[model samples]
Target chain A: MAVCCPLLQHEGERGEEARRFSLVLRAADELCPWVEPVALGSCTLPARGPSRFFGGEARLVDQLGAAVIGALDGAGPVQIGAADGLFAALLAARAGVIVPPGGSATFLSSWSLAVLRRPDLAVTLQRLGIHTLGQFAALPARHVLARFGGEAVLCHRVARAEVGELPGLRDPRIGHRLREVRGELPDVTPQAGFFGGTSAGDLRAAGAVARLQARLGPEAVLTGRLGEGRDPADRGRLVPWGSRPEGRHPGRAACRAPAPWPGRLPPPSPMVVLGDPLAAELVDRAGRPVRVGATGLLSDAPARLSIAGGPWRQVRGWAGPWPASERWWSGRRRRARLQVVDGGGEAVLLAAERGRWWLEGRYD
Target chain B: MFVSTDQGGRAKPDLPAELAARARPVSTAASRLLPLPDALAALFPDGALRRGSTTLVAGSPGGGTTTLALALLSTVSAAGGWCAAVGVADPGVVAAVELGLDLRRVVFVPRPAGAWADATGELLGAVEAVVVRPPGAARPVAARRLAARARERRTALVVLVDHAGGWPFGPDVSLTVRDAEWEGVGEGHGHLQGRLAAVAAAARHPAASPAVHRLWLPSSDGSVAASPVCPASPTRSATTAPATTA
Candidate 1:
């Protein structure tokens, strides 16, 4: 197995340049589904199978180098190596060397003990005068194991290219852990397939909404359903996108009015139902505050009403004065509802309780 | 190395007109016009909602503003088109479903207060049709800008405004519910069922004679059906100004 070691070098490239790197990976995936492709700012591509398909090992390496350089838009210093195992291939790739079959031990022999990646062993090897992999491999396995334990014995075998008995010796996936130090390869995202009619458009729309939700909070995309209630505020309810509508089942109630509450305002629902009722002032022509008596009669006819910064308009016609009181026996609730049209013909729903008035909503 | 920049190089000859025509961009205007409910077919110039155009639907609150708006969106939604409502909190989901809007296909932005215009702009890019109620008082400049954006996006925009007032800016066309009377209710009793409304509409550029029709706006079964045209009242001309509902 031949592994191509792509020189990563620049640390800053992992941030903003990650996108360009992923594009390169995607382009490589399109060319060949390389087994256990590892990306670490730089990438490793095991070239054995692909090398045969592209005509030869040399041709495959050339094509891969071209593809990487193309993806990076001519960024260079892409080095590749071919050998019996990844350990020897990685060492050979650093020197831009390619070792023939059966030459693994000779290829690894010249490398220094530091290439073993166990710094403590490297320091010990240096102190013991075994400065190179060839010299380290010359030491007896039994002596190395008894003195240095199992970890150094394994490193000694890798250094001598005697790794055939080791688990996952030629497996590319073994290098995945090392690749993760920089960053993990993103999972292959699921994509929408071709479908007839507006489904394609719908998927595109859903994608846009998802992106909006990601940028803003989850509440940004909301779904609203009409809920059952006499009060307009309770009538329209919104829930987070994709969730089931809660509260009353809008289909259960025929008129959207709870059965016990009889006098729900008929047709001409307000255009805008104020979440909170706005304070209103209603006075009779004589400048006295108009009040609704206990009998649903006005103590003085309302002459003018003003609400929410809009100019005070003259009252044209009036109806209702019906009781909107809740829990009468508790002594907690008291209010009278009325439908009043201004001189401009804009009708508004008003509730007056204890000489205080509120503009509940306006008819659209 | 000599590079041949021209496509096909010198070796390949231009294809015949019939073959070349296949590569030309096709116009989508005919298919872009969306269907409308049977009752509203006559209101539009093309008898369908045209993409990239704005239509204003104005009526008194509770008088059928929501009903008519839902009716306008029904056909499109039934055809699998996605619809959006901006700055509209509760679209009376019951009324919407009753009037034929598929709830699954609808997206609502309950409180679009400060971001109403921005939200509408975002929805226009994705939805096939959008109904927007201006947050607070309407602004002419913003309305005009949004109208241009709708044209660019090719999304149908239905502006829901109060019939008692005028739109901040003129739309490509306007449909106003002149008067609406609820049926299935008497002086004292009866469950509410449907509405009878007189709708008058005119386009910026007239498609035909002014469209005035009396509609069983979502008749008892929850679908808009045409009713006989009511005689034009003496006090107001349906074509000229907004008619106050009696």
Candidate 2:
């Protein structure tokens, strides 16, 4: 299967567009398991294997048509072109013709010059009155080649059905890995001033960490926490990589630490460790959702968050002024509060009104 | 190439007589063309899906429209074409896995706010096939843009319509899935057990009349399969006597 993006020229910023094209290719890879996409001009795979598997060329084309339809699933209409070469297939698909075998030359013979005039090449061909493939092909190969340079030579070959060698097959075994970090600091105060007050800093910190991790490779970052004493220590862990410490070991510190008051400080709340730290959000462009990352919300926040590549968006209606404070008895006490809302109207309250914002527990 | 003719020295074509006969000029009105499959089938037919054509698969909730869509994906993947499922509200990863699809080969794109149509259109330009599950609240214009994109990219699209309503693009094929019958199997002689039912659906193709097929869960394996439960020939009575309940 080959994906050809005709908007390569019309869309400004070619690099960004190409990256988006790659994302679509990746998306196609995920939607269909049987067919491996070979990145050609946009993306292509040899039809020979597929044809054989489907019984014959005709069957293969039918299967391809169905596959394309299945892939689109009504998001929009789609066109499919399958043929012997990259150019031929694209042309066939564009013309809405399922060209039969040995019809490449005939198809090229009738192809209009407009088809060859890409935005990048239209100006160069106008001077020659080269309006059709037949007209261009009629010229002496050497003369045409001399005037247009290598492009003319390549076009001449394509028109004559002497296209260049096919691109090599891509490694089908390509894979990826991710790393991440998460933590929960409860019993901390919420400052009413900031987004979520106390937890806001940690969330921002987690965002920064996620961004840093992304630089290492393509990954996503997520920030969320549970409510008051719910699974205390406010659990968080990176997936597909670093994992929580397992089994009691002398090398690893246990949850308990000696309290300064000999029985105070809430038994030294459990420590947050980076467990199986795997990163999320592996994508090129096109904003394609490659994988789902961590789903958690700050205390007094929404129940769930859908993190693709940016800040977490609240899942349900939840707005907060989550009131929280720490070191209440000491002169060093702190307070904070915050609110979080999603584009879908769901809001979460992370802090309550106080002289200052303070960190508070999460909702779910 | 040489030309041949009859004894009077008239040039005759080298092509076979039958071929020559077939090439004879004929009026369009005289031709009998095959009817187009319903919009849904047109989009993902067992044969070539005509470009520039739109197919709409519309059904109510729990009608198994999504299941049918996934089944099409399985067919496409098995045939070796890259495919994608975009904007799927429910990822349904387990179901896809159960169908024996290659997870790596499939890409799942989640777009919550209908903004996915634009990005999906751009993506469709490069991929072999793309499936977009528009949010339930998609507008008519959004649907049209998607259709336009499909035409521009020459991509085949299968739109899953969640509600029973008309689509912006008068699809070349329209399919509706409905429950046909329900049966319950008991764990023991007097114990009521799980319920199973068969679904009857119609595929209306463009240029062609509608055809009906029945989908039922296999008794042994519990997988859905479709067969021509209703006969097309006119030899038998259109209506048969209903089976009596015990």
Candidate 3:
């Protein structure tokens, strides 16, 4: 089914670039319908499980070639090469595919010396006049190994179609996201009403409630437990708005209010009991709550410091070129401190030793 | 300085039409003098060397002047255009292999000891782009003739001038490669340690001002990597200014 199409298509009048891309895409698409299409370099179809699914290796490849031709719209002059390694497949593709199951070695053995002219193998092969793949394969494996090392063995393997391994396939479905959450709030009191709208129930019905919860600021929402077990499904969930699950018995249920919800809410209204106050805060060098640090200071050495996970930065503005030298007795105890302003407008002390300077600590 | 206050303002004589035309900014001339890359945008950013135009790439050996020329050749060939390289210093096979050049579309013309210019002239009209490393010096007149032939045929003629030698003819863009430094080796005993230096020096025609740019070459792993080169120094010559459009 596939063979006639690509062979015919290859004969058609199409731009070379477009033709090439389409040919590779169609080949891969047809050969491995189980695996999604992947275009890596010049060839498209790679080694995978589909070869086994279509009954033994030979049948798989014949099918792949046919698929390639079909995808190419029968423009075949399509070359199909299947080997354990990408390099081998590429070489085979360049050299043309082998017929039947075990013909790869014979096909590769007759290949020309020019194939070995790949940059990595060229220089070493040039000395021996081993220009073609056939010549390279004829050389003693041990001698080739001793001279060109492992690469020679690998090349020989490629030439002999004894390719040992296939490259790992990359995950195609990882990190894929499809759902989007949207909501409209009329007032702060009706914050839950927003989620209770059409989209909310639709998302809940789809079992995508977790995704919706993730979309709603997770940190702002608080979870509460119901006092009485009523509706089995709604026993543990209550939103910021004064909305409770409709059930026969009214028990204390888990309740949460998003602090950042858009809309006005009545001040001091008691919809849900607060557990603990949580707010974002910054810490200072001394780990104390202070308004600002002192800026005026005199020191000779320049201060250098860096923010956590940030780039190194130097400080300017000092009162004096004061020089302090210590550690003369111990031979390794020098320390010179300087004061400078940091990004936060805090004056900090920087120390220098053995010529290199550092911001040891900050001042309050 | 005393000015002639001659009120013989019997109205100054009107300038001649030819002089007036010269005085008026020539818009076309300004565009014609744009750098080759800018001029080449009309063709391809990675365009085929213009047919019949002589492009000069002059630099010291190992300064990537030849590499740049070969890269251009590769690009053209990859585009399915036919090309030929004549009078190259390195062996044709080795050069093709090193540059990853497609030899199928290329005709390698070995550098005949004394017949480089003649060989290039012979192949110029037949190929889409011809890279020639002419033997000895090419006279400006001969270069001009070649350039004229190139222009007439619309064939791209890339002339690799050895070292800092001057071009035989005024090139549409004569790019000169200057100061180059070798990137040092990494610690340990890896033979793949030494790569070409990162910096490249270039002077474009029309603007003859020299510029030093950091070059990133393709690596074995097929990753693009960067190397720093010496910064460019300001031009000293005041006579040449960049071509300005009216």
Q: Rate the local accuracy (lDDT) of all candidates.
A: 0.63, 0.40, 0.41
User: Any runs in candidate 3 off by more than 4 Å, and if so which?
Assistant: A1-364, B1-48, B92-100, B184-188, B192-210, B217-246
Give all TM-scores, in the order shown: 0.50, 0.32, 0.29
Best by TM-score: 1
lDDT of candidate 1 over A1-364, digit per residue (tens) = 3334344433241232433455456556665676343444444556667877888878877777677667676544556676766677666666766677788898888888877767898898899888998999889999999999998898888877877233333445324423222223101111111112224456545655554444454465665455545665565555555332233443233224334345566544554556578888887888687888887788877788888656778875566676767666898878787777666545567888778888877653
- Residue A203 lDDT in candidate 3: 25
Q: Arrange candidates by TM-score, highest first: which order?
A: 1, 2, 3
- Candidate 3: tens digits of C-alpha lDDT, residues B62-113: 4545555655565444333446666663322322323444343355444345
lDDT by residue (B88-164, candidate 2, tens digit) is 54333323432333332344444324346754564454434456667765678877888887777655576777654
Worst 10 residues of 3 chain B by lDDT: B185-194
Over all chains combined, what TM-score does candidate 3 have? 0.29
- Real contacts recovered, all predictions: 0.19, 0.00, 0.00
Across A1-364, the per-residue lDDT of candidate 2 in tens digits comes to 3544454312231123322333444454543444433332245556666667668766765665565445434433345566667677767766656666677767777777666545344456656666666666677889866777776577777766667222332323121111112212211112211222332323333343333223332222111111122112222222111122233341121112222331111211111121222122222123333221122122232333433244644332322222234454783633232333233422112322223121222110
How well is each residue in A1-364 modelled by candidate 3, as lDDT tens digits? 1111223222112123233344455456655753322222244343456656787656776777666555555334665555444445555555555344465566666666555545667666767677666777777788878887886687777676677332332224111211111112111111222212222222222232222223332222212223222111122222321122234332211132222322111111111111221121122233332122123222223343454335534443332212343334776654433334433333333344444444332221
Clashes of each: 8, 100, 39
lDDT comparison, 2 vs 3, better candidate: 3
